[model samples]
Target chain A: MFEHFPQRVLVNEVVTRDGFQSEAEFVPTATKIELINALSTQGLNKIEVTSFVSPRAVPNLRDAEEVVTALNRNTDTTYVALVPNERGCGRALALDLDEINLVMSVSETHNLANMRMTCAQSLDQFARISAMTAGSAMRLNGSLATAFGCPFEGLQTEDTVLHYIEAYLEQGLHSITLADTTGMAVPNQVYSLCRAVRARWPDLEVTLHFHNTRGLGLSNVLAALAAGMNQFDASLGGLGGCPFAPGATGNICTEDLVHMLAEMQLDCGVDLAGLLTQSRQLEAIVGHPLPGQINKAGLRTDTRPVPESVTQLRQSLEA
Target chain B: MFEHFPQRVLVNEVVTRDGFQSEAEFVPTATKIELINALSTQGLNKIEVTSFVSPRAVPNLRDAEEVVTALNRNTDTTYVALVPNERGCGRALALDLDEINLVMSVSETHNLANMRMTCAQSLDQFARISAMTAGSAMRLNGSLATAFGCPFEGLQTEDTVLHYIEAYLEQGLHSITLADTTGMAVPNQVYSLCRAVRARWPDLEVTLHFHNTRGLGLSNVLAALAAGMNQFDASLGGLGGCPFAPGATGNICTEDLVHMLAEMQLDCGVDLAGLLTQSRQLEAIVGHPLPGQINKAGLRTDTRPVPESVTQLRQSLEA
Candidate 1:
């Protein structure tokens, strides 16, 4: 039944790297690896294992190299890592990563706040890094941060976002992502951006990285789907929040997203039950309730009769 | 600018009754009143205050009559109470509710499982109740439960749901709500049901009630919106779940729904910030976290530069 449907859904798991990085408590390396390997069983096409930022800046992902090197990568699954600069690129390169994602903000205010550099300077740096990775086995992807709307600037225009994309493409990057880092991208903005991007660059492999900050994450996904873009980056249980961005919310809940896709009669190729079990494990490891809905409330496949159970429990309690 | 939008979104708050009833613990009656009053200030047009069910069945709502009687009853807002039978109707009538919503399942199996009676018996009861309520000032709204799909029976036909609506109309109840009780609804199901129901009853006021069980709640809302159904029932922070039907998730999050409506430039007349504050307060009163997203991240409102005091504190922390 599912084979006839086009493979329009691509889930990118960021649980290990993005989810754990925001935590004040340290997650052991073994737990991080366990989470990544468990995610592979759910048939994810890509998994963002870690970021190669300086250890001093983000202590949680200091073991980025070890996590990436130890991944049980299948032939179909592509393992990617975030690289912020030249030093970060060196770490990813040493691990023989499948893809290295480079990010720069479109909003000047956010660009300075997040990367501590002017927009032009970040572009220049990406150009240098793009040159270094060209023709190598590893693919380079440029991420346009704050491309939807900026917390400081209020709204980032399509023209400004396009200019940055053009620059990235001019530097020979094969893939690009428009990220709503602060979850400011509404459905209208997402629809317009996806249409314009595909219209502007028909062959560009556009991936969307959205946050559920204002609850527009999945709706934004629908908008992107309507615009014919498929690839998405999500965290299981919506676990991650940007540490630097104040009031930033969780990533799109992976199970929720998969459930939506599966019922829409779209081919997501994910085991919803397996993902729910993994989410419960994630909640246990994190030592707090994770923000996923499907894990707490199992799917239609879980057909345990309720009133009988409730009656027996009530009778037991009363007795 | 928002006043000109063709679609005026209406959010019916279902937290006080649906949300609290799902919890095992009893929420203090005073807290329920406070939450409803707070929601009134958030520009919600309607609030489903409490259900007048037998106290023995749902002990959480033992004080339903008292809670309904104490509502603020603001002139601009409509207060609704759920009445399951004539006994429940007597209690609701004493409270002089603005609207009395009568709920019955569309599927025969669910009607038997949920209300412990056949569909014919429920309709006969509704006919008698409609006669009793004929000349009253209170508006009677008949809700067709499990209109989309049911846990007991897999899927409900559009013909069956429309038949129930027609029966309610014959019994003089013009307002109707189509409920996806188990969240087994998809966009196609919503579109078909709305089209069929609207075609039969041209002037009927139809509301769509969806659970986020399969993560299609908001997407189903969009489908209903596309088919011209504007009113929706949502719980604060998506807090409601079905006790009779296990695996049934909570209602759509009110803040998340309002945020989407507002961002799409639709006029919901809801105060987003005030709703967020109430969500946080609701979280505290319930002594648990919520599924609300907009509250954790502020709206797309323009952010001011960091105050010098906070900047100094941030700098100190970095140092």
Candidate 2:
């Protein structure tokens, strides 16, 4: 309804990759396949199926290859995977993924802390992967981790982020994601950054990935939307936390984000009710209460009857 | 740096009233007094200290009179109390309150449900309160609960809200709060309604009160701020919820709200670090963890050293 907010936005579900990665115990392959299949039909624009990292590093996603093999793929929804390095990208190349996402942190220390590589090494890896996937059917999307701020280094500069975006564009990556890995983003900062990025590259695809660690996730989303972002990465049931930041909420929730979009009367095509139902299933799968609010507080349409106390008070007042 | 947003915004803390009102156990009179006293010194522009409702109705706030009397009065802060009817207003008039807040719901059903009175009856109560406070120095603030939407009646129209606001103004209330009682507000709706309100009543002191139930709390605040609001009501540690909406989050957290405002570099005068410390005390008082995120994640300035794993990865790469 506002000036700059696009009528249509793309919701990219990152539950399986980001959400499940934080689980203390392994989620079975069959269960993962079932969830992804169920979500594929729910009108999500894309699903980050899994991350193609070493099993020893992230044992929770040890079945990434198998999960990719068995997806009940939907033509309407593109399937994607997070590929960490050239070796991971090589594995994704063999898969039936529509897109392979290459990620690096905008912060130097966070790149070392998260990917065990310097920002330079990660850029080199993205270049090598871009060349490797040159002839492949799969497309590449560069994800900048700690694009807003770094937990180890505090707030990163906008110039640092812009330099990395320039590097990603050089690699022929059409889509780029601004990842708030630690949820340190403020709305004004989000608006300023997104406006700059959109102004610089009008045709480039930009997706916003936010964490709810500090409860600014959805606010940051609103700011980005107003600043001309139309693609977002959200975790189903509000799952995922960085391994370094224990007990912190990870991503903007899929159901909550969709509910807000629908409430704003934006034509973000995802079924809120279906996502709410899936959030329950995810809670059972993860064996804990999710951080998502829509699942707990039903949609605005879910009207309630008058409480007995209110009724009793009304009767007393009349008397 | 953006247009329309004022350099200085007022923070109104509502923990002792809204936050403690939902507590299953009665907080001791001394503890409530202690909390209120501590918050007064934290540079908060205003604080909804307690409600003048009946002890029989809200047993948790049975010590409302005691809390009001015990506050270490701060000249820099305005102390407020929510009074439902003439009798409650009468009790507040006898106290040392800076402001007596009159509350009602814009939604008809919610008005009846929350106050055990119709909208007309609530208006009559506000008129009675205005007359009661005419000779006294106490200012009156009209709080329109469910101003955004009603739990029992779905989405409420802005016209419905403006109608009640007009009635509230007729009673001589220069200040009013638009309360999202159940967190049904979307950013666009907030922006639209707030813009209209500011345009019509340029001199009215408007405060935005939001719940984090649907995870749109902070987003709604940003929208209202952009729409020309300069004051807000937030609870400490995010402690408060509608009794009807079970398992729902209540108001936007004081700490998180201040944290975001500080991060935006806005000239909101509250000390964020002090609120963070108080949140820990609030947790201890409640005997459970509250929903606020900043308390757990720390501030963006809270930087960590490089993790051991990252150090090992660096050493291996060097070797």
Candidate 3:
């Protein structure tokens, strides 16, 4: 039981990278930069500016360098980027970025499907990349994807998932996260796995990356919190997904996360209203509506009373 | 902290009653009956059938009596209903109700705004209703609305909110719930308040009602659970809210909740697929796009790989 955690939650903004990457239309580099800049002012600690994957693989993120390079970094904020392999890691390193998130799936089927390699091969590659980044000030987050459940495989067992963690930890990747890549995780699974992982690696910093797939993402986060895990990965407006993964919808919306955290009286440090404002801007830029609920319905304090006309209309209908 | 909770989570389905009441559409009595019948088969333990409030007050739920009368009673499920006054209570008593939920607001302003009564007056009315059903087998749940914060008063103090609970317990209401009527609760507040309430009424059945108004509904529930509180009220597809409470978005979606609990290996007794099916039916009946996410995004196990055409198109666009 997390009897005493810092009464604060961290909102990692991934709108620019994750939100935009999933869009069919390419968001202009300038708009992406503007989004990041707007997010920085909104009191977010980390903004996933872009992914360093090959432009051919992910066309939307071709301007990763420009996006990261152009960000107005607040001293308190950290700028992170997702890197797939050595080539991508090299690009992240060249930027002297605040953090580099290296991701791989725990399930072999997803691992092979996602990264074109088996678990062992991906771990070996991670080990090589870990060795390359040794002694660097830039932080590295080794992310275990499909840690919850997999598309190809039914349920991801803890033993198989934790086996991957052993490799990452052995490689000196101290900070890591277990992602519900396809949003297959539930609260009990999160509780048991997080508890088991925490018991094994007490010193390791664990972040949870959840998708609102199946709509249990935030509940899974709560389960993790109960199991003593604090750090979480969320995208603004609940954006982002693996284009290859079917129905791998949006991430846990950032504003929703912060709004919940703030209401829970946790000091997430992110500005709730400002995030809502930025989320509105995000929706405007995207042209299509984002999935976040808080932005659509303003906070409680701002609610205007239902006008008498609407009330009378409702009343007459009821009559 | 919640090490002793039943591994199986209890999902109280409030859709037929709570969900439909929030919408302007007057769901037909037959449709409501069909909706509940569909939900009962979906592994839901407790499904709130309808509200017995005066037809004049809530035209949407005017058919509550007929809907409850039409339910298939063979299933080992608790069919509950919301009773607002002695008249509603009398109507519920006529039926074979398993449980009756008596609703009230904690904040004075909302109490007046919602029920046209002062807190004292509402409690007095509750006392009369309690007296009327004193010896009945039906379970009574004393629900304290705006327990976390109120739309009218802005931020509600814990002291003020708990005072209402103290009053309800005084009136012999043992099963009670603290509701975030406007989604004003943060996690720490939820944890601390749940702990405090538990400390006072150790035997009180504490159920939490959270709104996703600011997107903190599940997070708040998580905090309460961490504080060793269980039993939550959720609507299907995140449906239901105070139509009177502007900006009050949706209830914590039931499918979303069950998805989280079951995924955590905590049994919610809800057939995930069954719940989704019912949710789909409800959406079709409403004839509007539902706010639910999981239904549109197929299960996480559904990895039919994004079509080759999409990948090729995406790749060509990138090129």
Candidate 4:
């Protein structure tokens, strides 16, 4: 199993977008830019800066353009933004972003509830956006939300998920992400679906987006890794969730994911200590505790001095 | 990977001893018995009822005798207790315990810190206890703490861990548990160790005890399951930790573990709903928020009514 894992994995930090979008309080644009800048210095290859969505729908990311435009762009980091539709794409095109992530739910019920559109309508919208971005330097990545399971529709069949993947490929989207938007994925389901996807599209750059809602986030990551997945989307401090999806919780924490990968000796490029520092900063900015464990527990390398009581007890026992 | 897992697994609840010991307040003896009685009804095959230790060492469990004697034991549940020395074994022997679990740290540093004894002395004490229990009806089991890693000693080599296993076997104890006492076991390490143990002792009843301190508890369970481990130790609400190990946290939550197993279609012979209910009751008794995710998120089977906004949005889209 150890030999089966990739020697190095790609971690795409989505804190600025996915981590902040669910915040009830609108995070300051300067703070968002500072986070992005801090993350860029930590050697993160990809940072999702913000989402270009209707302010009424997601007011937290209303200043998406300002956040993206104000970034001290690091040449080494690929800046990405979430684009919900062609309008969002138009807004993203006005800025300098390395990638535009387009998302749609695989379940029609979720799609209707979240986007006020059917799955087919969402696909049509994605096609329009894909065409609009054709020949542009910005990369287009499609995310199939609720691909594993949905709260409203229950478990999704492999065929249902495969259909959306096929549609994304047909739209000429080379980068696709399978998202467990409702935190309903198990390791077996993750492994089986990822294996099937890898078998069909051997060259596709597949990424996984998992929620720690039910506490199986890291397990699903390990499952996907076993299934040959190399790219994953994680939020700093385990922030963000789907506003429309009932019971949806935070995404897998970027620091926690990096900590686990580092412990496993898998190279993830991003510095774990730097990521933890950012998690602390985000926690302070959010004005509450964040869900990431490493930030609270400290790293395994952290060796605290032995307490005096224990030393005294040992000495007493020796005597 | 799913095919590699057993069709059914065994879940042993250890909230009484492992979970309650770490509580800052002593849960009332009557409440402890009530919780144990409730857990018994949940179809859990085994429950670690309490630890037989000095009151000075663990004042929380000072009423171990009272609690065990008052339990409304279910015929279907096997009651177990943690015994640290010969005196503990004597106390457990007086009760109608189904098993006595003897614990010692594999790391000399941790053994000195936690048990106030060296590894050799602890082994000798376990031997004396084993002798006292010879020809008794109750089963004797040994748990090697810090089997995965130690806070004071770092990662224990496989040879050192295997040596402790050999010593336990020589003590005429076939029922053995390997514990990640400090939550330091990664999936690869768990897989490798479980695989090695299974290969060495085909018929040995091996149980794994994991802590979720680093948020890899369930992932380690998945890894162990893939390596053919069938039995695990979990607490009701992710309670319990080693007071001696810095950064040590809760044991894997029984409800969360069962939820993951049921979602994966693996049978653990435990009712998740019943466990969740008991977790709620335990939470109220503890007077604080517990770490179990299922208690807060509700089970996946729990389907919430669709929000009115989603219905209105769908109707408007149709119009």
> Per-candidate RMSD vs. true structure?
4.9, 1.9, 5.4, 1.8
The regions of model 2 sitting more than 4 angstroms off are A307-319, B308-319
Which of 1 and 3 is ahead in DockQ? 1
Candidate 2 chain A worst ten-residue window by lDDT: A241-250
* Residue-wise C-alpha lDDT for candidate 2, range B1-319, written one tens digit per residue: 2577878989999999999988988888888888888899899999998899988888999888878887789999999998888899889989868998888899877887777788888888788778888978999999999888888888889998898899999988868999998888888899999989988989899999999988988888888888888899999999997765678788999999999988888878898888888889999998878989888888877888878888788889889
The DockQ values of the predictions, listed in order, are 0.36, 0.64, 0.31, 0.53
Q: Residues A1-319, candidate 1, lDDT per residue (tens digit)?
A: 1122235688888888779888888889988998888888788988888999988888999998788778787777888899999888877888888998888899877777778766787888888887787777988888999898877777888999999999998777779989988888877678788889989898888899988777667778877887788899899998988543455467889998888788677888888889988898888888987666667665654554545644554466458
lDDT of 4 by residue, A200-223 (tens): 988899999999888899999999
| DockQ-best of 1 and 2 | 2
Return the lDDT, model 1, position A277.
85
Better of 3 and 4 by TM-score: 4
Q: What are the Cα lDDT values of the candidates?
A: 0.80, 0.88, 0.77, 0.86
Worst 10 residues of 2 chain B by lDDT: B1-10
Ranking by lDDT: 2, 4, 1, 3
Question: Which regions in candidate 1 have their CA more than 4 angstroms from the true location?
Answer: A1-7, A244-249, A306-319, B1-6, B23-38, B64-72, B244-249, B302-319
Please give, as one word, the docking class of candidate 4: medium
The top-ranked prediction according to DockQ is 2
| Candidate 4 local lDDT, B111-184, one digit each (tens) | 88788788898888878887888888889889999999888778899889889999988887759999988888
**What are the chain A TM-scores for all the models, listed individually?**
0.91, 0.96, 0.91, 0.96
Number of the predicted model whose lDDT against the real structure is largest:
2
Can you write out model 3's per-residue Cα lDDT over B1-319, one digit (the tens) per residue?
4565556567788888878886787888888888888888877768888988888888999888888888887457888899888888999999989888887888766776677666887799888987888888878888898888776567677788778888887887768878887777777778778888888778778889888766667767667776777789899888876554454457888877766565445766778888888888888888876656667776555656544554554466458
Ranking by DockQ: 2, 4, 1, 3
